[model samples]
Target: MPISDVSSLLPLLVAIPLTGAIFSVLINSKHGQVLTGLLAALSLALVICAILLGLPSEGLQSTTAFRYPLAGWEAPLGIALSLDGFSALLLTLTTFLVTVLTFYSAYYFSASPARVRFWPLWWLLVAGINALFLSADVFNVYVTLEIIGLAAVALVALSGNKAGLTAALRYLLVGLLGSLCYLMAVALLYHLYGTLDFAQLAAKAESNPLSWAALALITVGLVLKTALVPLHFWLPHAHGSAPAPVSAILSALVVKASFYLLVRFWMEILAPAVTNDALMLLGILGGLAILWGGIQALRATRLKLMVAYSTVAQIGYLFLLFPLLMSAEGTSASQLAAQHQSALAAVCYFIVAHACAKAAMFIAAGNIIHSLGHDDIAKLQGMAKYMPLSLFTFAIAGGSLIGLPPSAGFIAKWLLLNVAIDTGQWWWVVIILTGGLLAALAIFRVLDLAFIKPEQASEQVAPDNWQKVPVAMPLSGLALALCTMALGFNADLIIDLITIGGGE
Candidate 1:
């Protein structure tokens, strides 16, 4: 489905929330917060409705766009909001997760004195992220990315603690620098191609030295922002210190946004031959991060920090797709073998799977934090009695992360394994399994500690029920995680849409 209708409302889907943010901030009161939350929910609900109504009959691919002129002009000079299968998938995730996160935050921050402040900034961030997903031009993407980054920092600092404040500042500096590098790369692309539109640039980019430099800078900038290995120094600290809802959004979507940009810029705009080395570089670092992060997570004493480091490990799996996509045998080639790049499917599948599962894990962790008043893994003995939802949710999500059977993660891993074998490159398989095993070690460490019954009476402060975060919230994420696995059984559905018009 190509975008034939400029009145499809994709731009409005993003704009409504941005406007709602200003409306909410202007009326900052208890009534205002409640009203804003309701408005935010309604706007997102409507966007999802629009998506549902427009979901392609074809199943796997869908797209919609609004070629709105900024004051009345043509597309080459103006801008447009285009939603392809990939962008639509991202949009659905953003809206679904925002709705859940908003609901969870209602209770997660209920006891806090500053609920009003959270809603405005949080909604604004969601708007920026949605806008990022919708933008078709490089400059628009950069602008939306800037807004998302600033609002994210504000959300992080809302905790008002030393750790949160410090992490926010550090994340800001690194984030801005990365943004700078990406902006420069985009500028170079514009100068070279005379176009900022992704589609236009894709056709124009050549495997020349100047284009190659732009590709390298863009790839490096996005990888840094995505927090792949060595460049991920700020993520664990920021994620560990933020409130649970914030952590969920950060891990599930925010960091992934950078990765999405990498996909858009590298796999779409730039010629494949221009950046194979960088992709391999990313994959190598991703493999290392998988093992290193999992082991560090296993050693962490605090639950939130443990979860944060777990993020570090899970992120590594995403990068594994790079090398597979970039080469025939970890070496660059002008032409790629179609049979060798099954890793693209694996990457898309894993991202969808991880988004749902990680969101659940973070919300569940919040439930534990709220109910138990602490996140120390050592202190959580017999927590199943009080935090069953949290424990079980973590387990289910962890199962997915570990590539266990009947889970989406497993489906994704199997595909990547097939790709490696098909290409006669089995070392990547070794890295994948090692990562999965280490993830298992980290997961069981927490579970074993949590399952241990204690002698002393660690009084449970929360009442038995309503004790965990809202049932609907975590359940939504869990349901999505299940859908991710269901994708395997329904492979025909996604395959049909993966290459729909403009899904390149």
Candidate 2:
């Protein structure tokens, strides 16, 4: 495919899923699932095509950034969807995950009537995520963010239990508050610069009081949505009480959407207004989140909640990039630029690694809960005997979470450690190592119980009491987990794709 052909298909990434969402509402429940799955697969193909066609023929030079103006109108007056290497990488990640989860969800909600509602909302959430990645303007981002939050809330409520309903309500309220804050920032920027386009805002933005205010507002809003420490009170319950596939999507992709926006604002559009003090503050919160989330995970008695809290810890790793980038302030111009690129690349790797690892973990947890009728950690003794695949899936995914060697998580953390060391911020290195140790403890806590022999187990359940889980559930999870390991071996390809469009 030619670059132009691939660029023309960019809008379809959003359109196909959005159309599927609408059509799902008008179709039969079973057919809706089929349609949603097919559309998600198509979206994934589009993303793959974009990456292959947009890659330069030789070297590390970036391909041209493609922009598709809606209705022949460009930004400032009309919305434009963009397909640069950054957005392309995220789109590929988003579509790939959604495709796999769509299959997992088909079997997950197969017996439940909620499948009727799940398919539409699932596609809606996918549409929103893709749109947010491609959005060239702040206002469009806010619009897509709202779409994603609302769809996710609806999906969460589909669980139909009191706990699920309560968590969904809390999620809705928190999402609205975050959206309001982000909208305020959008309005402020538009008023000051008379434009909502990111490129325009970046060019026109000044290091002034209003810009700083907008920065603060954007940061708080995105941080709240991303479920960073201190403001992350709503994430655990919402992720834990939701259905397994919903839990997987929330941990793997939903939080990343908001974080992606925060990165764009902090590192690109608002770069001139960003201060070392602010970056350090973000790093401080990230470090605290790693410790606090890890402690919470260790304390969690339920398997799902442990994975949910672990998400909080994994999210903390991404924020460390901000402070590490700040540490390059005194370097030579070439060195500073190189450090910036490396830092961005590291965060990108972390995001993809976490998405795959965390999604696999949640699906594995879901499979265990599906088979055993509950996710109580203490009662999971001899899980290896009854549900070896699910337990193994969880352990393998957990290994990635713990940054074990030859896993994607190890590569991400290694890159981050190098950046910290190169920038002379050895303190972050300590935090990184400590967080990994804490993660290992939390992960192994489950493994030790699951792997115990039935005869030697402390809280063994009867073999006859276990229910049969669908074969697809554990297999899907294993596939995602293996993808994480595979990523560890192919960092160069991902890095090449990410560095496209000038590594922005």
Candidate 3:
């Protein structure tokens, strides 16, 4: 692969879609919607090509920074677009999932009235995600993050119900609060470090109150955004009440934006100064999120809401990588750094697995709701008989969620577990396995609905437009699930990417 652009292609990934956001506004109403989807698809395709055009190893290859010096300035003064292995993985997922999400929304809302407003907001969201993944500058990251919040709000509002409106409002309030905290943290960093770019801050930062405060503020704000445990009150209602595809994005990627920010901050901005105590705190929270999310998901009345709760649980798993990454018990610094890359890579892998699996589950639940006129798990019977594709998709995604063998989920869990044990963090191992077990419980609850005979005879199934759902959507989920399982065979390539990734 060759370099993508001589001067700058990195910013183009973000600018092109953002430009589409403006251009999409000029489109005639219905035409605008079509154009928006096309633009999103095109932008994503270009990003994939550009990403592929980077330095490669295998499995999780990434094209590093496509440096475009803003106004032809140098590194410290100009903004750049850096696409490391992790970012590339996420960028690809973001685009691909957004495309699927748009298509899914088309049929999901086809008979519904909200169909008219869904596409534009959905496209802007794709744009936001692209920008968020590609952004390198702290201030620029904030701009993109705000766009995500706004677009999500609009998407939520498209549901056009009282519950939707109320949920959107709650999301808005928390979103702004998180943004403010992040902004204040950014301000603190700029005040202390005098540079908003990650590389510069990294070089300048030392152990100090300002740095700790800024990092704490940023981490807490992001935790709020990711809706981790105590700060996650806004998520269930917002994701549960939104349209199906919207819920998929909310569960799959929206919350992940915050997680991405934290990872960037950790890996690029503050690797050394962050203490073991902080990592421990994150692990503890991760454990709670896992347990609480699983229990709540199992208890949810609505299937969509149950998936939302599962997301909460999935987030807990993400944080367990921290302590494992921070260890130097046996390994030297260089090896630990290399291991850090792999751990971070595992996070990315987990993200992709979760996104595909969760998307399928949401779509499956939507199918059930569409056919049955409700999503209550208790009411579902003979779903597998009626909707095999959807059920199979659900099962595949569930397999990934539970860390079952041969799936990408298992590979990710296996790698992280090894890191934990090597570092003498047995607690993390216990927590992860417990989380997996709880995930098993939640997944089986839904599957149980389909297998068990109805207590009393149930009414005949209603006519369903499930045929309208694209074969591509569920198949895409299945492919991801299967790929995850297959990932176990390709650990070497994944580890290679991670080895080079931290440097990229």
Every model's TM-score:
0.90, 0.97, 0.91
| RMSD of each predicted structure | 3.4, 1.8, 2.9
The global C-alpha lDDT for each of the candidates, from Candidate 1 onward, is 0.75, 0.87, 0.76
Across residues 310-348, which tens digit of lDDT does each residue of candidate 2 receive? 999999999998998784435786777688889989999
- Tens digit of per-residue lDDT, candidate 3, span 1-504: 545452255666666666666665666466566666666677767767665556455432223344455667655677766766666667767777776666666556656757566665776777788778877689988998899999998888787889989999999999899999999999998998788887677778887888889889999889999999988899988998888889888888989888988987876687656887898788889889999999999889888888999999999988887776676656777887667766776777778778877887887777666666677777666567666777777887899899987877888888778777767778888888988998899888878777554432145343352343556555545554565566667766555544444553
TM-score of 3: 0.91
Spell out the clash pairs found in candidate 1.
60-497, 61-497
Ranking by TM-score: 2, 3, 1
Best by lDDT: 2
The total of clashing pairs for model 3 equals: 6
Return whichever of 1 and 3 wins on TM-score. Answer: 3
Better of 2 and 3 by TM-score: 2
On TM-score, the leading prediction is 2
After superposition, which runs of candidate 3 have C-alpha atoms over 4 Å from their true positions? 4-7, 29-32, 58-65, 328-331, 454-457, 460-483, 486-494
